[model samples]
Target: MTTKKPVVVELYDEIVFPDPSEAFLSRVQGHPAVNLPRLPAGVTLPPPIPVEDASKRRKGDTKDHSLTQWFTNFSEADELLQLAAARQRVQAHIAKLRRQISLIDGQQQQFKSTPEQ
Candidate 1:
């Protein structure tokens, strides 16, 4: 018989994670300089996902929403701002990677079309 261990989710200050390691906790705790942008007038935010509800989701269920889904309420303003900043940083990195890939592709095509020595 196999025994299933209970999932241990901990919330330290505002960071929530299941079974966190020391390294993970160290990296994420307390970055105080984050500035959360105020929601513009007439903007409709998506409903926030409760931490309990999120923990109950199946492994593949998480991919259906944005990173902001968990912090989409007025109550979670700081978290929402932190998530938004992270999203912006990631998008910038992705754009840089895409540009590098395009440059590499162009070089490959040019090399293929050149006359053999």
Candidate 2:
């Protein structure tokens, strides 16, 4: 008797994925609002002014740079320091107010308990 060998079959040989670039292009092309510039009505853009002098231009380094970069380099330690300082000040104020209220309540109770002189 002759031994028979079974043939192996491959599946998904014809399966192909679509190109990402082509898919993106197709999506943008299909969308109607992809290329339109969105702006409110009655807002006319001013004409471009040529900057002829660099010497006369006001520098924003001292003002804008400080504001924009104020917290850029901040660390958790710095935040905790500020938070602790604020908490201490607030807690002190609250303690003072509470003491004042307690004194007022004590005075009121004393006035009520004292007989008319």
TM-score of each: 0.37, 0.39
Query: Once all C-alphas are superposed, what RMSD does model 1 give against the true structure?
Result: 18.2
TM-score of 2: 0.39
* Candidate 2 displacement at residue 47 in angstroms: 37
Residue 40 Cα positional deviation in candidate 2, in Å, after optimal superposition: 27
Candidate 1 steric clashes: 0
Query: For residues 39-65, could you state the per-residue lDDT of candidate 1 as single tens digits?
Result: 779976776677787777654443445
Go through the candidates in order and give each one's C-alpha lDDT. Answer: 0.72, 0.65
lDDT of 2 by residue, 5-38 (tens): 7777987654323445887778866798768565
Highest-lDDT candidate: 1
lDDT, candidate 2, equals 0.65
Off by over 4 Å in 1: 1-75
- Candidate 2 residue spans exceeding 4 A from truth: 1-71
Model 1 TM-score (2 dp) = 0.37
